[model samples]
Target: MAAVGGLADDRALLGRTSTAERVSDILRTRIAEGFFPPGTRLSEDSIGGALGVSRNTLREAFRLLTHERLLEHQLNRGVFVRVLTVEDVEDIYRARRLVECAVVRGLGAPPFALDGIAGAVADGLRAAAEKKWKGVSTANIHFHRELVALAGSARMDELMRTVFAELRLAFHVVDDPRGLHQPYLERNQRILDTLRKGDAAHAERLLADYLQDSLAGLLEVYRRRVGADG
Candidate 1:
């Protein structure tokens, strides 16, 4: 719903070669990036036409994402980005704590690669300065992704991509982006600092606490929103 009309220029991708998986990946990333937000109905015709992919291909992509729980296909209503329940939010944080904390705990040595994490932190700082709340959230996500990348596993990265994409669904629900994400800017820095000191245990604890506190705050708001609607 966030303006898929301008995709005409992307026709080049089709000429090169397009597949259902690629289409799904693009949409998934768009969803994760907060472009087409939660509850927005995806127009098959508009998206397929724009991406220069066949309807069948696009539908397959939709099917894949639906399986991922990032999109839900309704009966004759169309595909809509999923709105996470409080339960979904809790589950995502649970996954974050398990994987992210373990990654921090399993660091091999001093002078671990902190470049990616550092860059993400810097990006967050810059976005904060510019008052780009969405950018800040994205940078936060990047920081975690880089953190997971420390585990040196492709499967882990792939899994977390879906996890983070799902987490973005929760993010789109909140009205105050700054309120949801601003406090974490400093927390992200602290985690990075802890890692830089070669203190894996300390970093792991920081990450675990960060996840717990984040879950608490997000649940509070999500409950209120859903309850108000109910």
Candidate 2:
């Protein structure tokens, strides 16, 4: 029954949208940002009061997230943030491999600009140097977001945002943020460096292998924490 902080600010910023959609989006972003950790019980009264929404409106928002697989409602235990399983970790990486590598492979065919990708890399490097592991994690998320942006499809961008948000739930299970993110910083740079050489094939291969290794590692951590219960 530990209530997460920060909803007050988001609630104030929730201005002028369908109340249910706004509540759902705020909750989704909270879950994505790890403000609402896996398995945290969500109290309808608490959240509805905080967001200044009616119980019915809050319930609708909860239903939306439940449909999105970001939240689950127990028979009598109320709703909780979805804790991803090892299988979910595997499936997400599978999706990432197909999408991210394809985007990289298409580089230079229409010549996707590297500006956004480079910016993400620079952010990760800067965050790493500052010893901000959470910043590095955020930057890593940004890097992948920028990678998906290469496709130039608004729909793909929207899909990746959801995918990455779900992915972040799994990432929260890792105890050592630095251990999880440090190695990837250099790997991210290498991928950027490889792409800079205009070798899409090599870059794609590198990205695929990177995702595979990451998937295996995450599965191990997920098994230890969430197990088969997800």
Candidate 3:
């Protein structure tokens, strides 16, 4: 009987491994897909039960996501999806533009990783065409991230991960991602063209303007949502 009980426990543990992974995937998709909007309450008991996992395992998954900045935890009230303010958006874009534009200028054009950036842009265009807004957003983020990575600054890359995650939270507030992302497809191509031409200075200026315009549009939508929700 003891041996049977031990076997059952092992099966339960195995089941938990699967459940945690599924929970992570589900939460990521929901957040990215905007099903769980910013500031939405996340009940461990409810979500864990729904996903067929123990509370401990669910907590572990939540911790991982929180570290990624996709979720926030409040004492006593439990976890909630992160919400981005206008100020938050401004700060993120400021840091991103500063770091990324500097990276571009510093690269000085030495046969850097254009292929990776081009591939990401291509993937983003395809995702945009298919109306997969989340995928498009992620791909677009990756394109710029790789651009910064060209400078070989590990710290900048890490900073970008945090900024991008928060930016995704802001994106959840907006309704039309295609309207937001589609206009930039051509802009990205232009930036790539400049970079490929080894004109890093020109690329930096174009990237700055692009960041400004994009942030303005996003903030307008974000403010409107905050007003409506308030």
CA RMSD per model (angstroms): 8.1, 8.5, 5.9
Candidate 3, RMSD to the unseen true structure: 5.9
Clashing residue pairs found in predicted model 2: none
- Model 2 clash count equals 0
Q: Which one wins on TM-score?
A: 1
Output the better candidate (1/2) by TM-score.
1
Instruction: Name the runs in model 1 displaced over 4 angstroms.
Output: 1-18, 228-230
Candidate 2 weakest lDDT stretch, 10 residues: 1-10
Badly placed stretches (over 4 Å) of model 2 are 1-17, 108-111
Residue-level lDDT tens digits of model 1 in 10-95? 87666434488788889988998778989899999999999988887888899989988999988999999998887788889989
Q: Between prediction 2 and prediction 3, which has the larger lDDT?
A: 2
Give the Å error, residue 208, model 3.
0.7
lDDT of model 2, residue 127: 89
Better of 1 and 3 by TM-score: 1
TM-score of decoy 3: 0.79
TM-scores of all candidate predictions against the true structure? 0.89, 0.88, 0.79
